[model samples]
Target: MASGNDMKMAEETYSGFIGLVKWGTILTAVVAVIVVLLIA
Candidate 1:
């Protein structure tokens, strides 16, 4: 029972981490493009 709960928690955390990274990368790319446009 404890192991099952732990597995669920880990899976949630992993998914949350992936979500953050996905959004973070997208945001970073957008900001970079904006900066380049402004500089140009």
Candidate 2:
């Protein structure tokens, strides 16, 4: 059904968004650690 397909698409989009946020946070944390080490 079209409605079922639409729901699947929405779920995929939501998953991708969460993945992006998680990766962004991890990257930021890594960068922060590197900067701190460099400055020290």
| Steric collisions counted per model | 0, 0
What are the lDDT figures for the candidates, one per model? 0.97, 0.97
Residues 1-40 of candidate 2 have per-residue lDDT tens digits of 5598899999999999999999999999999999999999
- Where does candidate 1 have its weakest 10-residue lDDT segment? 1-10
Q: Which candidate is the best by TM-score?
A: 1
How many clashing residue pairs are found in candidate 1?
0
Residue range 1-36, candidate 1, lDDT tens digits:
559889999999999999999999999999999999
Name the lDDT value of residue 12 in candidate 1. Answer: 97
The regions of model 1 sitting more than 4 angstroms off are none
The true-versus-predicted C-alpha distance at residue 28 of model 2, in Å, is 0.7
Q: What TM-score quantifies how close candidate 2 is to the native fold?
A: 0.79
